[model samples]
Target: MTERFYDQLSKDFEEMVSWRRYLHQNPELSFQESNTAKFIADKLRSFGINVKEQVGGNGVIGVIEGNHPGKTIAFRADFDALPIHDEKNVKYKSSVDGVMHACGHDGHTSALLAVAKVLNNHRNQLKGKVVLLFQHAEEKPPGGAKFMIEEGALDGVDFIFGGHLATDLPVGKIATRPGPVMASVDAFKITLQGIGGHGARPHQTIDTVAIGSRLVTHLQEIVSRRVDPVEPAVVTVGSFHAGNAFNIIADSAILEGTVRAMNSNVRQQIESEIRAILDGMKVADRIEYSLEYIHGYPVLVNHKEEALLIEKLVKETISLDAFVEKDIVLGAEDFAYYLEERPGAYFHVGAHNEQAETQFPHHHPRFDFDEKALLQLSRIFLQLANHYLVTD
Candidate 1:
């Protein structure tokens, strides 16, 4: 069954490419993928699969029930693009201005769509059912996954799986690791209030610029000095705003940044440290301030058994050399929300092709990956589906 599915996927490779390129050219932003959702639903319906639309804000769900009874397996793919201008000169470059599928969500969608076609074609031979989650708003926080789950996308799901196209890894290879594969994403904003005055009369004003500068420095120290060296963490001050004029002292200053940690304890510790630093600044600098810390996605922890299953399937289905045990990344994935609810694992399919100018990292304007990675992704999802629906 797996061999037949692989052969069918190989034959449908061009069709998959067409789907991917079409989506890449007409990319849509997170939470606003109405037309993309329609396109996906229409394709699934054409394949004779049961389709559900407008799920959790533009998410699409397709289900295929088998002739025999067995475990229900779920697969997920995000379809949201980023807010970046297309810079690549390819013929299929994004047609939308100031918005592009810079993160390979287009590839993700096309891969899963191809898999659904193959699975739906062979639905009678399978056991139990297969659920395809075409998710939205993965690039933005409070992602569509959360809402989709609340709407029962995984209501009957026994095990779930997801994959990403990784430029960091070479093509024909895939990678995964059990436990905390990605960090928790959180952000913060600090506003400092002080008295505005003439630059020459420095003593008359609290000088928020000076205080905010010191605040940035102290914030950096949280990861370096406060958090344990063995524990991986990051604190980045991405934006800072102050006075417009160089000669005048600004009455207020605003600083915005992000924080990442591998574990909940470390995550909490960082927030506490930030608050403590703010308190110290208020007492020492005699300035009023506000700290707004926004929590995004949680750390992505792959289930040990499920992750091992992916590694094994990659080695057996693809070449043994195609399987790579990767290290934990600081990047965050909203897929973490699914794994938290159901037993599952998320892995990366290598899409990097140095000879094709496709080595740019994700979320970059020029970012792209070898389209051949789509076949690799579909192969894995098909193998996973067969493992649970047939072999088990």
Candidate 2:
């Protein structure tokens, strides 16, 4: 039965790829995916699926009900693109200036659309319900997943599944693990205020630049010496700004950076250390410092049972050799928000094209993926939905 459905998907693969290319050409950013939302809604509605528009500021949900009663399963796909220029010279390169789907979100969106179409046609064979989530603004801060959740995207969802396109993995392979698949991404900003004076008079002013430099070095030690070596943690001081003129001492210094950790214990440890460093500096330098920490997204931890089920399904549908139990990724994903609210797993589907130099890592101006993976992704979504609906 699964093979027959996949065969049907194969027949529609070309059309699916065409749709993906069209989306790639006209990309939109984060929460501002108005046209993209409309396109997705229109496609879902055309399949006779119940469509809900603007659920969470440009997010669209398509619900497909089956003939029999069973558990509800959801398949999610992010719809927002990045702010990048398409340098890849392809026939259907990004037409939108300063915006491109370099992260393969276009392919993700197309795969979900194809799954919706296939499931819509096989609605009678399905046992329960399939919720198709087309999320927006995954690239920006605060995340579209949080917005969708605020609007009740997972109100009654049983099991949710999502996948990212990975250039590191070879084509025809899938990689995933049971726990802590991705890290929690948080950003910090610190402003140190000190007395400004002439550079020649060193004792008259509190040197904020000197204090800021010390803080950056101290922050790096939080990961290396404070946090456990087994647990992955990173503190990157990406930006620093101070001083106006070479001869004048600046009144204030600004420091900005990001923190990534796999577990909450390590994350909180780093946060506490940062506060200690800032607090101590206030007393030592007689300077007032303000630290702002903006928590982005939580760590993506997959449920072991759900992950095992997905692994079994993939081994059955595709070659067992194609699945790999990979390690945790240092990168973060907004899909973590959904996994926190429900039992789910997020995996990676290979989209690499070895022959083309355009097959670079995501967020690159020339990054592109093979369109052939769309059909495989579509098959996986369809199989996951059907398998979960019937089994659960």
Which candidate number would show the highest lDDT if scored against the true structure? 1
Return the TM-score for each candidate structure: 0.98, 0.97
Model 1 lDDT per residue over 1-392, tens place: 99899889999999999999999999999999999999999999999999999998999999999989999999999999999999999999999999999999999999999999999999888889999999999999989999999999999999999999999889999999999999999999999999999999999999999999889899999999999999999999999999999889999999999999999899999999999999998899999999999999999999999999999988887789999998899999999999999999999999988765789889899999999999999989999998988643
lDDT of each: 0.94, 0.88
Residues 125-215 of candidate 2 have per-residue lDDT tens digits of 7888999999998999898989899999898889899988787777888888899989999999999999888999979999899888888
Per-candidate clashes come to 0, 1
Cα displacement (angstroms), candidate 1, residue 152, comes to 0.8
Least accurate stretch of 10 residues (summed lDDT) in model 2? 383-392
